[model samples]
Target: MEHTRFARFGMVCTVDHLASTAGLSMLDQGGSAADAAIAANAVLAVTAPHACGLGGDLFALVHEGGGAPQALNASGRSGSGADPGRLRAEGHDRMPFQRDIRSVPVPGCADGWMALHARYGRLPLAELFAPAIRYADEGFPASPLLAPAAAVLPGVDAALAPGDLIRRPGVARTLETLAADGRDGFYLGEFGKGLLALGRDGAAGGSGEGEYTEADLERVNADWVEPLRARAFGHDVWTIPPNSQGYLLLLALAIADRLDLPRDPSDPLWAHLLAEAARAAGHDRPDVLFEGASVDGVLASAAERRATIDPSRRARLRDLTSSGDTTYLCAVDSEGMGVSLIQSNAAGFGSMLFEPATGINLHNRGIGFSLVPGHPAEYGPGRRPPHTLAPALVTRPDGSLRAVLGTMGGDSQPQILLQVVARLLASGESPGQAIGAPRWRVGPGLTGFDAWSEPDEASLDVEQGAGWTEGLQERGHPVRGLPYGGAFGYAHLIDVRPDGVLAGAADPRALISSAAGR
Candidate 1:
């Protein structure tokens, strides 16, 4: 609750209190939003290593005043040695999700940091990294959020008590190298060598994940591409193009837009509409993709699907758990530049491939690749997997930035954003109100599929509050209630108020999620 103490400042929001402070510190130093974002994320890598790290990939939407939003795809590609045929030959029917060499990819977070800094950073890399370095070296107390991951991860020694000091000297040294040498420090220099060795160590029976050569790491660069744009709620929403599931947000919103949403934030009808829209949008996942994908087609199809859903029809709900351990942060500088950045290590502790010398955990983002023969997302050398890190930026037609927003929920990212944006635009809710509202997720259940049935047959999990259980069942949705404040995915938001002031909110459902500004 201490972290939830919200006050108005030049807006910044992040999942960790310390990282939020770090971003505001950058803003106070006259840094641009890009600088603050990288700085905050660096701190997050240390404080919330369970979710993200220096060994992950990053995606961002950066808006420099008076220009279109910039989309940065820093996601890493599969190793040049990656071969789906080999895995298939090894007797695997699908991509493996375990901690193995096969899960590792050339990490892109370091390259992403360099790219943002080269384009928009004001402070030196050393100065920007000071806070993170200090935290990793001198140590900081762990928050409640670290418990679950620490309990399961191999080497993390999470602080037993809330105020206990936790030190990450290896991470500290790694940050120092990065600050001194930039991206090369991680990909081609000392850090890179160590990472390569760790990959070699993770090699399986005959398949070697360590096949990534120095060239693969050095060639990794964050591409600055045009953002995928869609017209929603009278504002333009921008997200990273292709190799990401961002279009799902626009598609779901477009579907919900066709409905008459209840005025009350707690109305169960909002949940039903959002759930159906999310399921419908996810149905056409391949069509709205970034590789030459179209917004018009996605919107038209979503609208058609929306018209077919009957609120009163009950669909089966199943329980399913999606993969991903990710983090999202938002920043708006005094200069009016804004950024929405999301980064991740795939599953928890990512691949569990640790560089014994540096303590860096390699990401398992390759797990996102499909093993199905001929699938667009099928595993291949030099191919980036379908990423779920969807950072969102809302801009008026005039190009004025409206909101910098995102979350850490893997497949749930777009669905959560759909509901949050709807509340912000349709009902005129504040960022905190919209983010804190009860949420629901519809996905494949742990049990087998429910009879190729209606969308409601998907497992539905809603937070316990606002009479969701009784209300949803009455509408014929097979549903279950999760504990209040459980991991329904945490959303961070910074939206521009009508009067030009910036408002920030951290999801109350999460412990230690916070916002701060000058």
Candidate 2:
């Protein structure tokens, strides 16, 4: 088991050791939690490009010393030229997922960094970007996670073994431009031109013409909105609102709280109840997950669903779609400020379309949209698609921050977070203990292709040592045992003790993840 790192002043946790180090450097330099989070995220873009990069979107929950946590939705919208009609006519009944350039949403990471910095940065934006720029310009060792997707990336060698040094001068120059010109550096400059060219070329190859435009790029900006809140486990839970699937976590927690869940982690009943709650919450996603949709009804419906769960039997639930390769990181500063942030390429190497001029690995977030004419998440000009990036914050009833936590698993993000949060709040587990415990995921079992397709039969995939597979199977669940690895997702967490000490943990599923503090 991993040991939690405790600190009096600050802490940073991420899926990569180098990224954690970059964030710790910011905190040491007097940067706030937001600054450290942005810095660390920048490094992840360089070190873990297969999961996240300049071309992805971001969502975060930032809680200052007092009041409720704030939500920042930095996800970009489909281009003004987006045409569901064109895709439907071309035989696409659902969103295309295999290297379809039409699935590339406007990149939002650069703008998101600028938005966060503008709100709570004590250091210059350029300084926060320096670590990433250095790593990209010089070289960084390739991680095992980056190897599988390397073939789709331009500069990265497909044959790269773990620990081989790889350099990305193109990405370095793009980062330099972002540091110098802020949001304009990527969206309105030469990088933007490169994206336009890529879009045109991709369209010419049967995707339909004019699927991108300058207006779409120039209009990009992160929006600050109210977070969805729920009371569970004697504390208030918070997550990003719609357009992001964060409410799924809140809804699941709400359902679980009403049920008589077993207290012991090893108890078969505990895993059974949690998995049932996940299925209940997932059932509401297709109807309640669009941009501008209200989740209040879904959250309120949790009570009714909770009453339907039978401890002696598995609920015959239909499966929800899942996909993604992303990064999640969190930071807490001395002043009690906390930031739970997540950023992502929709899938491994995203649209698999690497722009040569700027070296941007465009994301396929548009794949989250539907082609059905009247669907809430139907493709439309300038409309945001449903998202899987869900960052969460936990606080006491009095509004004092308690924990900053989240994970990267596409549709599995909420399920992973639900397990960790339950351990911390209900079982009183330490950060490391909660994060290191065995996990289970309930989903449709397909990724990177037709991710948002209609519901299929759901299956339960439990980590090998979870020891509850037999229990679940006996209850009628189609259980699949998976060896410990990324199938469960990489989660990072920081628990803020009432005494002001911070304890942090990084998931072992992430090969080089770490929790650093002073």
Candidate 3:
């Protein structure tokens, strides 16, 4: 029995129920899906402040008129204070997450969201911001997810107290200004002064060595490019262009293509294939996927090389950190348009700083550094980190967009999405079934020798007396059965069927998710 419900003209799908309500209200007011998305995003920033906020990165994959999608890279860049020379002079080879003002970059999100809204918006900013502004000012109820997020995160109480109006008067005013003047107001205008002032103070400096100035914000611009993907099983698979973790999703698809199996949801072989595909993606991460400007370079490589890969190598994945921070949202309108998007602060409560003046939190993508100096992705001024932040869209043969997705587990997000996609395409699982099914992750497996990985019979068998763990053990993978409800990525994916019927699944792991439409 399918537990999913379908709706028509649904303009909002989100990880937070309040955000979903906010967006749906806009749609009810005759707003486009994009406009509703902006409202929902704003609400999430206010409510799920620890997940992501205006002070972070906002990347979107917007599709229109059956055309190729446009990719917007809203990840902030290094500030003027981000001089590589200073680090070298200080005898530091690579930067860490806790740098002084030198580490904080000009936030690219507020402008990014405004730019997208301007390109495809209808309602004015004031109407769109009402829900978020009201919630922030009046205080909304906290969900279970937020409680833990606050507990794990630093400066939570300062950002917002549980049950308080949690007002971000400054940020709300900033949004109010954006509602009036648009993106330019945030990136190139008086808001620039506020950012500079924040930098001058101790807001961005726990390490006290930052060197940012007004010049960085003035020069920072949101980049627009073509998103890339490969057609498979009669569906178009879209992902962000390189400099982000887009290719990882494609590589997993390419690997799944190699196996060519029946779509059976309960097949243990399916789980094995997912692990193999993820391993293939993991191994290639350091090579082919990371080198590119336009996605064509790597997309072409993936298309040309969709050969069946050996699954044996998956047993030996590395133990480094697997990314576990970020947020994603997906929505499709009654007009047949679908969106696959992502936004993040790099880490929870990113950059660990919230400027009272601007009501913004900075992302700590700086934490994605290598202490090793000679590594390819070493820290530097104006260099974009290899983000695990990726969003996805799947178009079926019948001109249907079955899914739009992204997840919270950074690098592991691709693996999690891969498993769900495989469940839908080859394993014959419903949206809810695919999302609710047990899950497994590889990076976390090797990162903490004893960490649990959900989903795979191998993971379950090793711990829950299942049979697959024997296969995993025989194959030499260091496998640990995760206790139920553990560290899989928080997935938010929506599926729209033919004739405008819509259904979505927000991973139970996250408390903030909903689907509503009339």
Candidate 3: worst-modelled 10 consecutive residues by lDDT: 448-457
Instruction: Tell me the spans in candidate 3 whose CA falls farther than 4 Å from its real position.
Output: 1-3, 88-93, 148-165, 188-191, 198-210, 287-323, 369-376, 397-400, 445-468
In order of appearance, the predictions have TM-scores of 0.91, 0.96, 0.86
Give per-residue CA lDDT, model 1, range 1-518, as digits (tens). Answer: 12223334466788888998888888888788888898999998888877799889999999887558989999888777777888899888656665666667788899899999999999998888899999989988777877545544335554366656677888888889888977787788766888676555655532545657788888865899888787877888888877888887877777787778886767778787777778767754533343434455666676567766678754332332111578889988776788999999877677766766777777888766777788877888788887778899999888898898998876778877998898888888878788887778765333111111334345577776646666777877767777876356778898876576778888876678778867
Clashes of 1: 11
In order, candidate lDDTs are 0.76, 0.85, 0.65
- Model 3 clash count equals 18
Q: Give the lDDT of residue 36 in candidate 1.
A: 89
- Tens-place lDDT per residue, model 3, 244-348, is 777778777865776754476354455566666666455545443332444454444443343433444334334322223567777777776666667777666
Number of the predicted model whose lDDT against the real structure is largest: 2
lDDT, candidate 2, 50-147, per-residue tens:
88998899988899977799889999988877888888988888777857777888888888888899899999988898999999999998888776
* Counted clashes in each candidate structure: 11, 0, 18
lDDT of 2: 0.85
lDDT of 3 at 322: 28
